[model samples]
Target: MNRKQEETETPSKYMNQMIRQQQKQLLRLLRKAGVMPDERIEVRDSELLIGLFSQIRRLPEFAEDKKKAAMLMHAMDTIFKFPVSRATVQKIYYRNKDF
Candidate 1:
């Protein structure tokens, strides 16, 4: 990539790509080990969580009901553990999704 491209890319965007590459490698390793890749979610990928939330947010049920918003919040709480702050999740959750 050129310097202009590198300068334009957001850190989170770059991180997401790296995380995806790692996940692909893990899947390959799992296959080599005769493990069921679908049965495991070893790493918590924030990009994925955000994508799920985005899709759920698009749902008419979730969009029209305040109570349904609680479900997404609860899912976020369950998704992140200690050392990963609510602020961190919020930062990622609220960041621009242009990429």
Candidate 2:
């Protein structure tokens, strides 16, 4: 690699960027708080896709219950980016009180 290429970019980095853009680009913005990964890997499209989706913390829309929480927080309900209801929140404390 030339000095200019070494200082500016590498083949693997270039490939990962291309792969990310190619898949899930058009519909990504439509997703709620869609976030791009800060890191990229030199892998095939299928492997890169696995890395992309493996970290998502939610169930698919079809699998989730669409009903809103009894205690809605106006129009926004995400607490640190995970959807939860008051009942679900209450469960967080159950472990402490359980004997």
Q: How accurate is candidate 1 locally (lDDT)?
A: 0.63
lDDT of 1 by residue, 1-99 (tens): 557767987456678799879978987898788884344233466666665676666569877985676668656655455245677765655554632
Model 1 misplacement above 4 A:
1-42, 79-83, 94-99
lDDT of 1 at 44: 63
Error of 2 at 82 (Å): 3.0
Off by over 4 Å in 2: 1-11, 29-99
Candidate RMSDs in order? 14.0, 18.1
Clashing pairs in 1: none
TM-score of each: 0.40, 0.18
* TM match of model 2 to true structure: 0.18
Query: How many clashing residue pairs appear in each of the predictions shown?
Result: 0, 0
